[model samples]
Target: MRTSRVDTTIFGATSLLTLALGGVAPEQITVPAPVASEDAEAVAGLWLSADKTVRLRLDADWSYLGRVAGRHRAAKGTYRPEGTGLVLRDDTGLRTPVTIADDVLEMAGHHLFRA
Candidate 1:
């Protein structure tokens, strides 16, 4: 498993940027996480909707925004999967709890914004 320190740029809810390790330019245009393996491979992509909602894509980059009508509405932070939940770091660097199961995510704070 490659646990190297990668450059992760956190954009607010309005814009999004792709992140990659070392010099390996992001092959895809979305943020990915490790799935069914110890190594961080491209599993799924995440993004916001036109109405400011959070959405997750499988095996592809974010295509468009989502509708804003969820618990994570107007949220912003750095998201990383941890076991059965996602670790969401808000703009203030505060760690918020987020649970992801069956392709649906539940959050305790507003963290559905883009990266």
Candidate 2:
């Protein structure tokens, strides 16, 4: 008799596997900074592509929706306004951190001029 087996994981799904293996509880998720609602509103507006690389224009009216990577993408989520900072998220459940000051949105330390 012979038997062989190997464990495998799909790409982009490792996060889930890691959580399951480590038995990390949902409440244990660590958020670097607590987002505030007020800060989200401050960044709601039409943002143009400055570098023309990412090709993202943010439209935050009632909720956060924007295009990213030169593609027309919509993200349904909330943001916590932090003074001059904004944190965005979407239905896909991804958190995007950005800071807005004087009409400039600083996404990942890169500032995008207001359109």
Candidate 3:
């Protein structure tokens, strides 16, 4: 008989994980980490492309979706903080670096303003 590995993780203000094989006692894993600070949480919001042609919605869940004006959705991706900026990994597997300061966001050759 082959045993399978099971991993379960719970994240938020608290992070806990359980892992083990079927019918076996699960081992607990504790990782020390901050849930999500308000400053980092600030990234969750809407942003507009400099050309005023695109609007991107960033959710707290790391979902990054964008839409073009009067057209269909454009780019979709996930983002995580990298250094002082953020890196956007699109559906195409492209990693785009983004920098934000104040109310301005610079990414993918376009300047985005908070919307």
Best by TM-score: 3
Tens-place lDDT digits, model 1, residues 48-106: 33345445332232122223465554445445657655565656677755554444455
Error of 3 at 88 (Å): 0.5
What residue runs in model 1 are displaced by over 4 Å at the alpha carbon? Answer: 1-43, 46-74, 109-115
Better of 1 and 3 by lDDT: 3
**Which rank order by lDDT, best down to worst?**
3, 2, 1
Candidate 1 yields a Cα-based lDDT of 0.45
* CA-lDDT, candidates in order: 0.45, 0.60, 0.71
Candidate structures ordered by TM-score, highest first: 3, 2, 1
Model 3 clash pairs are: none
| Higher-ranked by TM-score: 1 or 3 | 3
- Candidate 3 per-residue lDDT, tens place, 1-115, comes to 9999888754433222222233333333222232233444678899898678878788888879877778764789888877667888989998988876666778877789887
Quote the lDDT for 22 in model 1.
Answer: 41
Query: CA lDDT of 26 in candidate 2?
Result: 50
Lowest-sum lDDT 10-residue window in model 1: 57-66
